[model samples]
Target: MRGFSLLDSSGLPVAKTCFDPANIPEALHLDVWRQASRCGAQVDSLQRDWRFRGRTSNWYTDGVVFSHTLCDATHYQRTPRHIRRGDSDCLVLKLQLAGHQQGIFGDFDHFSSPPGTLVLQDWAIPYNITTTPYEVMAVSIPRYLLRGSHLMYRRNPVITWQPDSPQARLLVPILTQTLKSLATASAGEADAYAAGITGLLDGLLLGDRELLQSKYRERDRLEDMRQYLSRHLSDPDLGADHLCRQFHCSRATVYRLFQREGGIATFILRQRLQRCMQEISRMGVVQKGFLEALAHTWGFSSRANLARHFKAYYGITPQQAVEAARSHQNEGQREMNAPYWRDAYRVSRWLESIAPGASPTEPAGAHGGARQGPRELAGH
Candidate 1:
């Protein structure tokens, strides 16, 4: 195969590199093969008596790495050390064009992929696999680019869809055609193809019921907690324990739900500060006593304490924010009528619609109904 290089739209080099065992003497083939696959996994053809013949072509772009390979039976293993090396944090999707493969991924989660099948592997986990002489087209996508959560892969890192499976039927032909076309594609075209493939994979994966349900539960719980916090922002006892009691969940659950927001306490403080800012902006040219009252209502000890945190978070004092709001009243009014503010208004209206004492267990519309346990809230 011929090799070429071109600059992508972003000015990064897009290159296609090829490796053929036939180009080199037989004695050096194993060493070269080992080196080439090292970044992904440890591979050995010794079980086939090291009489290996293979050729691979790889296309590298900004979004993904695509490779086509024809190789003899080989063993591949990724262990803790390989994961720790952090050479690749990609989710690999391999479409089997010929032959069969099987693997034990992430603590004996076994899966098989036959010709015309598509297999997924999360490189963050350890795996062991052996394959018969096979021809495959594989794409490696950075984990961050994909939708949904990585937590879904922790227990079951390897997944396979048979030739007749819906996912395989939809993806296999498109992937084959795209990989074949990459050889002649311009840099701009290559990037577009890569992005298209990544988007398809994201849609496919997000369709998994397990992933969708898990995400829904988490999102619902977080939204519920946020609504509760918004209503109770003026309450001095609103904290993790209070959330646990109100939601009928453990303290750890509350903490984990807000972990991304820098813990429950921080989220509450930030919300309170935001409320204070909104109040000050609305009041305009407030007195010292009013500032103190606003601070106290939002759980701050004094105006001075609120000012310290407000400046730290927003990079300006409360007084300055008030002045700025006054000067830009018309602009602020226009912004308040924008789509984003409209959405926020709708959300606030929805929050107000919920009863103040309603818990997650109650039917969303009314104050009283069947009570659900934390497990139900988690969607398990």
Candidate 2:
């Protein structure tokens, strides 16, 4: 990190450093590591080519943000075990300017991010990063600063921008200019400036709502599928393949839709258990062990299986739910009714009617249905 600091007289707030394997001495490499260690990052490898050259400029904005630019020929960097454990509170948004880089973080496999890519790297996890000849502008801001942003919940590393995409053509230049302006501003104004930068970043991460919704039709389809499943919870054969056929989507699409919910089968099981609870609350002890019959109607294979899933999901047994319902009735209170199954069933039938005799792997709504485009797939 090398940049002139506005704060502190000892060049403590800003540092600008350069490295050239061709001419710079070995001691400079040691000095680079020392500077990196102070900031909780490490440079694990340098390109062997004598042509390798790099520059790092770091600016400390007190506690607002730590900004740095790393321009280099090629390198491999890593957050060592001890460093990750000790400095696990910040997040880095690295914008690629030149060549491509690839890395693995958390559950994601190696992701190859090209230029114009904005990657959010978590300091809490160790990552193995390899970059080709590239120049990157990185902003280190506390995880707390972005805690509530949509990017925080995306659970992915990269936000790619195609060369001709609106974000790439328009937003990229805006961001670049903003960063440049921030570089010259006084330290006292860092917080205000940082906030603006973050706001712009949020906008870049989550574009206009209607447009975003139109682009990510998969999300819409998933929501529709959830509603459809809720209605057909009573169908014993209602499962992933059933959902695929009903939604006119493939097995992969169905799996991807419910990936976060533990897959389509798990989602269906949970919905069935939830519906059973509704019925239990509505019917109460009047239909003793009627809970088991309801379970059968809702696709659970047996009473024991229903109890297992019920207890796991609700932290209570079906019998316990019945007791709670009875107690509520005694107190002259009522559990809110779930959506009418008849309506859901009708909607399910309608959707099937529209798609009619569709193959399991065919995309739903593709025949005459509108779908999201490339823009919807652009964010974190």
Candidate 3:
């Protein structure tokens, strides 16, 4: 597939990329589709015996990713591996146009999304979903874009608006029409449509009072617990029982509050590992017994214990993490000097001619063709 870019009215580039399995050999269809969709989650055919056929068109503009997909029944999962890699940080809003889907999303129990339902998912959380042969249009907005919005602060990461609900009734048609129009829209028209859709979404999410006062109170309590945990992370006894006593809640209440994070124990362990990584990065050198001291400071029993958990959580040993951090710092320094060398090289020939001194050779261009700046879609 070739990528192409279009300049919108403001001269900003809008990129689009597409994938279709029709022209490819049937045997490679699923593999190709999996590769195309790997950016968001792991996908697999759900049928016992099936031949897959699917198409996806994605447009990227202003840090938002808009996509339309039509595919066979498939299973999609965002596992802890995907979360640790930190690639799927967007909040996805999917409009289910046809077929049905059932999934476990964040703290929500198993739920079904019927036709015309708008499903919102925070990609930071893990999910497991399986869909019947379906057609859907989705928009992925960066989390930073909604950082301070009320929607992000909600306790639940997954939400849905049923087809008959007022919110869905108001949004469904506009979203469907906009996506259809984008398929054949000019650059300027697409930009205008995208902007309007974004504005509508912002208004809907921020102005909706679907969350009751009781929900807000629960969210506040949950946040308070989280702050307390952060403050006392080094306390070796920090667990459900400790949290329960400190927050004056029952064990069940504490556990339920952190259920989405895989229970309080998992949450606390992850926090300690993360804090250990931060501390390691700040220390310029790993001194003798540093790992052992750091392990004790972060509530780990010993260096070996810390290494085992760190490797399991982050896919790297603590020492390797320190080495990687130092390597990254060196790479950053090199990057800081790169522009100066590039500028000097650009004028090397003139300097040599004027002063008869040795001059740096210019680097060859990496490619010889029209530069590919943005992604491409099927039509435009």
TM-score for each of the candidates = 0.52, 0.44, 0.54
Scanning candidate 2 in windows of ten residues, the lowest lDDT window is: 371-380
lDDT of 2 by residue, 98-118 (tens): 776765443232345678776
| Candidate 1 lDDT, 1-380, residue by residue in tens | 11223332534334565656565445444444455576666665513234335666766654467888777665576778776655565678999888777665654345667788889887777776666678889987766566432534564477778788888888887789888888787666777777778778777877887654657667667878877887888887789988888889998898888886668787788777656755664565666587778888998878898999977755557776666444322221223343333322332222122112222122223333221111111110
Q: Native-vs-model 2 lDDT?
A: 0.49
State which candidate has the highest lDDT.
Answer: 1
Steric collisions counted per model: 0, 6, 5
- List pairs with backbone clashes in candidate 2: 2-15, 2-16, 2-58, 3-15, 3-16, 248-364
Q: Roughly what TM-score does model 2 have, to 2 decimal places?
A: 0.44
Tens digit per residue, CA lDDT, model 3, 259-343? 8667788777877776676576557477888889999998887889999997765445788766644432332122223332232
TM-score of candidate 3 relative to the true fold: 0.54
lDDT of each: 0.63, 0.49, 0.61
- Which residue pairs of candidate 3 clash? 4-375, 4-376, 16-375, 16-376, 17-376
